[model samples]
Target chain A: QQPVQSPQAVILREGEDAVINCSSSKALYSVHWYRQKHGEAPVFLMILLKGGEQKGHDKISASFNEKKQQSSLYLTASQLSYSGTYFCGTYQGAQKLVFGQGTRLTINP
Target chain B: IAGITQAPTSQILAAGRRMTLRCTQDMRHNAMYWYRQDLGLGLRLIHYSNTAGTTGKGEVPDGYSVSRANTDDFPLTLASAVPSQTSVYFCASSDSWGRSLHFGNGTRLTVT
Candidate 1:
């Protein structure tokens, strides 16, 4: 099933912090976080498995809660390059991934 | 090496015409997927293949067909193109099911 993302859109100052949440109705096997800038392909940021493991990329970090079937992405000291659409993809025992509606994040100077 | 390559980076087709978007991966991944991205709709999976010669429908498979005759290629076809199908199509692959995916640049298709 497709996950639900919170705060469909957000605007932050260059140094501000933000958190994006992804929640699924079905049990999840893994959760992936991707960011897509205009006119570019979606790039993989990180993946969180169902065992409470966490991963980070630069100033971005993510946490997965297996029991709640939810995950959260944290972006600290946002930069202008962070402006883009963020998607959370969820996998539930299948070969295919279901992606969320996406969160459009804008970081301004 | 090209992780994944999608042909006709962009295309414009007549509403009733047939079109095919080609995708190839050199990573030797065991799984491949096709997805369409529309404004405000995020990315919706159209079809997927776990291995060569095996294909399965995804969330939005209507009006689209896919075949995986080999591990390196997966092409999506539209029998009769519709305006609603105009969007950016992405092809991705992973070593196995539920693994991290690597995506191609994408094909921007417009059904006029």
Candidate 2:
């Protein structure tokens, strides 16, 4: 099943912060975050594994809650380059990954 | 480094025509996947291969077929193209199921 994402769209200032959430009905062993620019493919950002702690890259961070079966992406001090469609792909012992509808984020100067 | 590559970056096909989207990965991953993305919709799985000879249907596999003849290649074929299949197709490979996957640039297919 496809995961659900909240805040279909979000607008942020250069120094603002935003959070995007992803949830799945089925138990998820891992959640992968990706960002896609216009007319381009989705690029892998980070992955949260089962029974593991959260991880981050630069100003981008994520948390995975196994009990809630959800993951959240945090964009701190958002930059203009952060503008893109963010997608969270969920995996649960399946050969294919299921992506969310995506959250369109636009960061302005 | 050549991670993953896809042929015919974009294509225009007539309805009812046969088309094949080729995908190749040099990472030697054990799992490969094909997905289609439509405007304002999430990426839907078309087909996937756990190994060289194993294939499985995905969320939206009715209009497509896939084959993993070797570890480095997983190609998707459309026996009969339709307007509904007009979308961006992406190929991905992972070391194992439920692991992080690397994606290709994607092929944009237009069915007229």
Candidate 3:
């Protein structure tokens, strides 16, 4: 099943912080975060495996809670380049990865 | 490396026509996937292959078929295209089923 993402859309000023959350009804083995610009393919951001692991890349970070069946993406001091549609993909004992509805994030100067 | 490459960046086809979207990966990943992206829907998995010569249906596999003859290629075919099949198709590859994926530029297909 597809995961659920909170805050369908968010607008933030440069240097501001934002959080995007993804929750699944089933147990997830891993959570993958991606960012897609307009008219472009999704770009891998980071992947958080089970065991309550947290990963980060530059100013972007994510946390996966196995028990909660949830993952959250954190953008610290957001930049204009961070504007894009963010999607969270979940893997749950299947060969396929299910993606969420996505959260449109706009970072303005 | 090219990572992943999708052919025919964009194409328009008539209803009931047969079309195939070609995908190739140079990363030699063990797993590959095909997904369709619509306006509101983020990305829906259509088909996937865990390794060469093996394939599986995903959440939205209807009206689509895929074959993995080798490790470097996976092609998605629409036997009879329909209007609903119009969307941006993306091919991705991963080291394993649960690993981060590397996506292709995508093929924009339109069916009228």
Candidate 4:
């Protein structure tokens, strides 16, 4: 099943922080995050594995909670470069990755 | 590395016509997938190949088909296009058991 993402849209100012949450009803073996700009392709950001783990890159980070079947993405000191649609892809035991609806984030200067 | 390339970036087709979207990956990845992106609907998987000569259906596979003749190429085909099939299609290749998915610039198709 496809994961669900919260806060369909969000607007933030520079130096602010925001969190995007994704949840699944079934157990998730892994979570992958990507960001897409308007009229462009989605770019991979990070991946979080199961068993309660976390991964970070630059000013972004994410945590995976296996028991809750949820994952959250954290963006610190938001920049205009961060403006884009964020999607969380869930991975079950299967080899395929299913994507969520996505949260559109706009960071203001 | 020219990680992935998709041909005919955008196309317009008439109903009941056939069209093919070409995708190629240089990473030598064994798994390739096809997905369609629509507003408010996110990305829907249409088909995937675990390796050469093997294919499987995904969430939304009614109007699409794919084949993995080799490790580097996976093409998506629409036999008899319909208006409802108009959307941006993405081609992706992955390794590491779905750990990360590398996507190509999508092809926007308009079926009239």
lDDT (Cα, tens digit) per residue for candidate 3, span A1-109: 8999998999999999999999999988889999999988899998888799999899999999989999999999999999999999987456688899999999999
lDDT of model 1 at position B28: 94
Error of 2 at A76 (Å): 0.3
lDDT score at residue A54, model 3, on the 0-100 scale: 91
* Two-way TM-score contest, 2 vs 3, winner: 3
Top DockQ prediction, candidate number: 3
Q: C-alpha displacement of A91 in model 2, angstroms?
A: 1.6
For model 1, residues A67-104, the per-residue Cα lDDT tens digits are 99999999999999999999999874468788999999
Tens digits of lDDT, candidate 2, A33-81: 9999988888889999877468999999999987889999999999999
What C-alpha lDDT, on a 0 to 100 scale, does residue A62 get in candidate 4? 97
Once model 4 is optimally superposed onto the true structure by TM-score, how far is the C-alpha of residue A21 displaced, in angstroms?
0.3
Q: Over the stretch B1-112, how does candidate 2's per-residue lDDT look in tens digits?
A: 4999998899999999999999999998999999999988978888889989999988899989988888999999999999999999999898975457788999999999
Go through the candidates in order and give each one's C-alpha lDDT: 0.93, 0.90, 0.93, 0.91
Models sorted by DockQ, best on top: 3, 1, 2, 4
- Poorest stretch of ten by lDDT in candidate 2 chain B: B94-103
Off by over 4 Å in 3: none
**Per-model DockQ against the true two-chain complex:** 0.84, 0.79, 0.85, 0.75
